[model samples]
Target: MATAKKLPSGSYRVRVYDKVTGKYRSFTAPTKREAEHKAAEFLRYRVDTRDTRLTVREVCQRYINERSNVLSPASIDRYQRILDKQLSEDFKDTYLEKLSESIITDEVNRLCGKYTPKTVKTTVHFFLPIIRKHRRDLELDDIRLPKVFPKVKEYPEPAVIMQLFRGDRMELEVLLALCYGLRKEEIRGLRSSDLSGNVLTIRRVMIDVGRTSVVRENAAKTVNSIRSITVAPFVADLIQARSGDYVTSMSGQAIYKHFSRVMAKAGYSITFHDLRHINASVMLYLGVPDKYAMERGGWATDNTLKKVYQSTFSDQRKRFDDMVDNYFSKIYDTNI
Candidate 1:
């Protein structure tokens, strides 16, 4: 432990040896005890792995291995997939010490040609953290990545969405997504125990990794995602009619395929995930407050809620505007 010394400027500074940098690092605070405490805390949790011989791929694998117990299965699977398919062999083989900003930028630019801008951005974002875990001193600022444009998604009216799946095998799935804004994973993870009368609690999630589905109990996409919402009478009846440990027996893939096929036949090309947009649109259409809508949809922030709200159907906006205009016109005529 290094003792803190008062400087000419009247600030306390402590010099602590960092194993990674092979040099003494400085921690400064207003008080002598605070400076020493800061240095001591750093020494307590400092990782001593200063292995300069590790390659980029090796560091990524090491990170993945270290976080295996903590990270979700789906996250691990996606990381592995990115390591295998997204990373270039040359980039992976490059030594961590030798990796430069230009190398990362070049790889990102190359990936933009092969994959979407969003995919390229995701790959670079995931790769950067692996590098930084081992080499904290590296400045990876302003590594140019492809710009991700906001995608315009079209969703059908709530009524049409209801009519399409009414009395069908996937009706329960549709109702859960549209009525409650429950994610597909949450829907698959639902069990009879999760339903108590008309109130359905979203507590678990089932994510697909490779060919199989992995269920995580008492877990969801976010803390806000684990919520309880009152279900509609028809939705409650549908859940009661089903006899199984899980509410819906369909796998994630099966649900997606069935939803897609049904939607395709109706001449609308939309995904099961888009039901959430429909849910958001309905909330916006019905003038549901941002707070309640966000809670129901498991949105962590109002930013996402505002995006969906702003993207509400053009026709619906026009209809509402016209109705208001007609009402104003009638009032003006009465005054004359």
Candidate 2:
């Protein structure tokens, strides 16, 4: 048995055998109180909770690593950046047991006031669940953690949602998205088996994981995602143009880029997903049932689309006024 000794600085030193790797290591800290507390905790844990081997950082690493095969490269990069650049710096050495609600809440508040509520909320979304999920999977109890983020923005403006859809090779995909509300991954993961004339089936997604590997056909995010969508004549033409050779890649960035070019040429600030909003807006304006639109958009719940994804009715009223006013001015060339 190794002895515990006091150094000149009033610190305590003790050697411990790591149950996991069966290695012995020495630890020195500034106080005997802390050393005894740590030592007792470790020895007790070695007997009662030896199986719970995950640290906060370790579990988080595994979650992100395993998700790489299913998430996109861009998404993986985003999650990793948050961990490596932000959360890891603060919580890397934090034992999961010591992490408290107050500590988490303080961190969340610090971040919330620092960035847009949207940006900060997303950061919370990425981390809060990650911690709890790992803890729960291990059947740990009463982990008094911080509050998860509330809903972000309540409803993101359709214009803002559309903004994310602009870019190269994105025209057709944009049309599908804005017109259909297809996610970026869903559009990129599309394949020939999902097509039959003007109807397209959405079944799988393509994701670039860890910026290194490309994984395809991981299936859609929900059961409702496996549905058929009718293609517009213009979109049909583009799809037709690519027939026999218009293949999608492991990454869908090219589709988005192409979409931006086409929208720019069409003289509209349009994007892949803007069309989705346009579709939703048009249907709502034309009085299509929200339930039907929800189904067409492959939305499982109407509340989210009505609350977030679908366009507002007020915009349609303003557009009606603007169209009438513009028509008269164009016909008569009036200044007022």
Candidate 3:
């Protein structure tokens, strides 16, 4: 039930009692009759909200559907996995509005014990948006997350990457990753038509999703990802020799399996993606400008160049330091 109150502006304000929250919800109407009508609608809405038991699972399903076209296929798969695997079973059936910070925090803490800190962080990251959109009353500030440490990405030496490039099975894949710093999906996404003279356009990426091993073709990772990169003459020659519409016929999983065997046989412990990191390290070591390196590697931002993939080989750093030391010695000798 709601009551009407006369306002200073001569408008009738309707106040409705929200039984669930025990708070008064107010709405303004121009006339007393309109105010009463508005209050009745508010009470009806309160009843409907309580009757509708939309679960977290339902909200997550809706979220995925809404974001399917916007997010990359891989990202959508990740979100689905988080909802199904990472989130606790206790809350899946709970109503969206009924969830509290304590319940979410307990679940997150339990997940931290089972999963890595990064995985737990990802779970929380995906969970917040759903509650924000559906349960605006649930305050997220009470949830305390565990401390997360970033894992440092280690890159193989330039010589190690070169050695992989000479291998027979994964030669082309290694070359594309090492030379252009292309991601695994980007390497798999390359097509013959993408090659125009010496330049290669990266407009799309191939993503492997789900347990079924379905490969989905999607647009580039970001807006800046759709750009052209000039290939070295050797890379161009290799592309010219390759058959099929795409660069390599092997799927990303197949390439990874091949790369693992190649590394095992060669007694080097490096992942396929290490080749891309090696390319960035070499570029930074050779004093390539940040902008040029970002553009050449299809990196969307300069921060990624500086923070993510800028580790130089220790030997190269030593050589650079020695050069500086020698130059300073020469200057001192001239002054003396």
Candidate 4:
């Protein structure tokens, strides 16, 4: 339901109302013709009052339910994490009207205080569009995305990461991650049957429940994550030696709790994710192609691969020397 009213002052006021909103938000325009135009837009954004109090959690969950099937499992997992572990908590009980920019910025800042800018940015990114979508549904306008946060350049050296790998409860998990670059959930969810012929088929992942943060065995992060990796001989031996009935099964909390202890106890100033970065960097250094590394890594973008993971290798370092020797050898050898 919408209408345009002519204010005595000359500007036209366009107003729209829906059962969802219970009342109309009027848009004032400078002319009658403009009022008609604005009225149409107002009608497009008019929300029903039955739904006036849209909560972030509700909208995000609905969005996940209706749209997530189209996304790869890995991507779905990442989105779920940003929402459940971060967004859901901040906006758990908030209404869309109550969710102002100040609150969002402050909450994100607190999250950034604990995580890297890259991580905080991801967290913000996952929710911004969804929030904007809801705002549009409510007829809000000019919604914008926030700036990407910057990450610290400093990190622990590989030697330090290796030191964090101890031979104990979490040692095997960290070893699998470092050697194979499997995600933490991937490392924790391996079943004995999934391993054979020196290959491990990653078929499942565990994630925190949207509301509770409790890990549950569901589908793997993405269909692609349900992949096979040839285990290094050492890793194969380590898998064989384990006494557990399943090769890779454990509660998600186990990895989190232990990794935290190991990092704190070892003073290894790095995140668990650094293991993946170290692995990808090492593989590129060993002459693996970008495609191979990206496929093996379940990575989503080349920039992330090239900028974040790729480390220049010997080939690049020695290209000039090798080319000079091979292509100009005759010139160097000439008597003149």
- In angstroms, how far off is 250's CA in candidate 2? 9.2
lDDT of 2 by residue, 1-336 (tens): 355689887888888787657787676777766766676666554522332345656667777899986765667777887677666356655666666666676676677666666666567778777666434333224323344555422233434333444333444565566556777777776766566886777877666555553434545656566566666555566566554422354255555566657556655455445555555665676565555567667766535544533443356534542442243224223321
Between prediction 3 and prediction 4, the one with superior TM-score is 3
User: How much is the lDDT of residue 260 in candidate 1?
Assistant: 95
Residues 59-87 of candidate 3: C-alpha lDDT, one tens digit per residue: 78788989998787788899999888878
Candidate achieving the largest TM-score: 1
lDDT of 2: 0.58
RMSD of each: 10.2, 12.7, 10.1, 10.6
Task: Encode model 4's per-residue lDDT on 137-251: one tens digit a residue.
Answer: 5322433334565556455554455454645656567767766678887776676777896667777664544433333344565544555666655566678877775665555
lDDT score at residue 157, model 3, on the 0-100 scale? 59
Candidate 3: which stretches are off by over 4 Å? 1-52, 211-218, 264-268, 301-336
Candidate 1, residues 137-159, lDDT tens digits: the string is: 55678777777888786777666
- The C-alpha TM-scores of every prediction are 0.75, 0.54, 0.72, 0.58
C-alpha-based local distance difference test score of model 1: 0.79
What's the TM for model 3?
0.72
Error of 3 at 4 (Å): 13
Model 1, runs deviating above 4 Å: 1-16, 21-50, 136-139, 301-336
